[model samples]
Target: MTERIWKIGTRGSLLAMTQTRMVQELLAEIGVRSEAVILHTRGDQLKDKPLWKFGGKAVFVTEFEEKILSGEIDMAVHSAKDMPAKTPEGLVIGACLPRENPADVLVVRRGNDFFGGGGKEKRGEKKADPASGPRIGTSSLRREMQLREQFGLENVSPLRGNVPTRLEKLRTGQYDGVILAAAGLARLELDHEPDLVYHSMDAARYLPAAGQGIIAVECRKGGATEALLRHLNDRRTEVELAAERGFMYGIAAGCHEPVAAHAVLGEDGTLRMRVMKYGNGRCRYFSGEAPESRCALLAEELAGQVLAALRPAEEEEDHRTGSRRKDG
Candidate 1:
């Protein structure tokens, strides 16, 4: 009898390859033969433009998802954050590895001052002044908005590239600092660098993208492939991500929406979620907690809170626009 081999499709970046290799090793452990098929996505090829300008996060996963749908690959591995709020009609996230650190990090040049407060006190260093607008590099609208509104980063600049490229630019003095996901840095082991300083942003202060730290294996809706993927699912991660993604989907927002939601499992088997929506130079926050078994409902309730909070502001804006048009 011959062993059946599965094909895993993924973006061809170093980080993507690293993550794919991790999955590959897991499959190998169970005597399942699989090969990684590196696909150069529009997101990878169009490194010059910011993600939103390139038509949002779908650019990163659409090709891979299409490949899966076309049966060119058995499955596609992706950073969960790159997935759209709604899964495409023919496919779904069949499995997800255990979640990693979901917090964002501020990577700054040596001796640069941008963030201030508690972390510095622990280091016995003076807290950096909040008003010193360090030139921060990031393409994420969520990160950019948080930096400008919360941290007073007046010099936010557009930066697009993989981790190594962005770090090199930071090292060469192109940016005073850069924002990156702590999970990716930890996965790449770039969290500890002699040339850079890392600050793990507190989740209470900085909400992460929906499904930010998860590795999702997506596949078509049914059959042997989906069955094979069921073995890879981490139940806890699925529940948590369900809540976070539900918050996103309920609000009809995607990666480009300057919205972030995160869910954390509590010691008592409950789930607590935080959601933030940024607009008009400010942010509205909503939170809810529920039994782990009811995460989906909890997420919907949180989304409702966020939407309710935004109604007044949105209506005000609509009224102002209508009045302006009438005058014109």
Candidate 2:
């Protein structure tokens, strides 16, 4: 019997909607008919303001979560990258699509050689890979640290906006090249992908943002869709994301602090987690693994490190926000 329709919920942003469409297509492969219910989130409206100034990272996916609780929607789709280290109770990630390319790329002006992104050495800085000098733009402190401090790039600035806006700015030569997630460019069909020539940095060298390149299908706990989701769930991805989010939670990374982590599942079912935290006097790396476990525990262990990083900065924050962070 053909299922008539499953109401899928997602944020109104282009990236969120794009991921939703991809999920719907995946459902079609399994003979499920689904509909997307576009929900407005505060993150979509407050484009001008930074996320921390608002309700922190909680504001990003909270509305869709509300919809799921209210029974107005059966499932919600999310970009694995934007998902925070923690999710609310009574909801579980039902499915996560096969991850896209998970590297970050440098997008430069019409004629810049920051990694020779657009055809090998145009601006004459081609003497050698100088390891330093040139401007970089990104919204992640994690990216900044990896690109600037680690790689020796001198100029790093914050670049914020939807995908199109960021690309347009790059095309006009406003920045030497901004750091963008490779997966997003491929999804949007852009030509300058990360693998093309942009220093091909590994996630180990640059711990990815928490939940990067992972899309999740979340449903109410013990719902009718439980079995369906388990069938769709990618255990390998679940393991990877779980480990990464766990590290983030450990570090207590919310909108307040810029942190990054990435996890990978090996051929033999081994899971490895890498985390980076740069705040106050701490700039450190942590790595660990679990042979067998659920996603929850993986996230918990990663969050443990994050918790350690924030111990010193605790006095500067409000109690309400600090307590309810990743650990909360």
Candidate 3:
């Protein structure tokens, strides 16, 4: 009897390739054979603009999804964070690999003293001027908003490119610092680069995007391929991702929205989630817990609370603006 080899669709970037290889290795360990088929996506083509400006995070996965639907590939591997709030009707996330460090890290050129005396100034101490503050580069609106609002970092600019390109920009003084996911640096083994200093942000204070640091394998809803991919699913990760993504969908969040959700599963099977949403010039946060089995309901409950809190403020702003227009 001969074994079957699976065709895996993936993007061509170094990070994408590296993540796909990790998936391949996991599949191989389970006696499954697979090959990577690199697909150039629209996201790769438009590097000059931010992701939100064009079509949100879905741009990166659309081509691979089309390929999967057309049966060109048996399955597609993607960074779970890149997944949009809703999955296409015919497809489903077959597995979520064990998560990496979900925290975002701030990387700065070595010897920079922007943090004042002992790295990071005390909260509420005088803030640096936006014009004079150290330049920090990041493409994520969530990170940029948190940097300015929470960390008092005012000078953040949009930077778009792969991990290496972003780091290169920092190396050449294009930016004094950059915010990057710690998982990428660890996966690429760039966390310990001698010339760069890494400050791991507190996840509670600076929440990560939903599904951050997870690798998701998507396949047609039901078939042999789906059965095979199930072997790679980590139960804890899948549950955590479900809750986080549920929260995202509950809020009707888009790539342009500065939203974040992080869920932690404890040994006792309790699931705790922290979520953040930015709207109408304000940032709102919510936290809740439930049994692992009821994660989805908990996420929905938290999201409802968030929306309820934001609506009154939104209506008040709208009324105030309308009144101002009438006076004018």
Q: Highest lDDT among the candidates is held by which one?
A: 3
TM-score of 1: 0.93
Off by over 4 Å in 3: 116-128, 322-328
Which 10-residue window of candidate 2 scores lowest in summed lDDT? Answer: 119-128
Candidate with maximal TM-score = 3
Higher-TM-score candidate among 2 and 3? 3
Write down the TM-score of every candidate: 0.93, 0.82, 0.95
- Write candidate 1's Cα lDDT for 118-148 as tens digits: 5633322322564344678888888888766
lDDT of 1: 0.85
Prediction-by-prediction clash tally:
0, 18, 0
Give the per-residue lDDT digits (tens) of candidate 3, residues 151-266: 77888899999999999999999998889999999999999999888888888889999999999999999999888888899999999999999999999998888999999999
User: What are the Cα lDDT values of the candidates?
Assistant: 0.85, 0.72, 0.90
Give me the displacement of residue 88 in model 3, in angstroms: 0.8
Clashes in candidate 1: how many?
0
**Ranking of models by lDDT:** 3, 1, 2
- lDDT of model 1 at position 93: 89
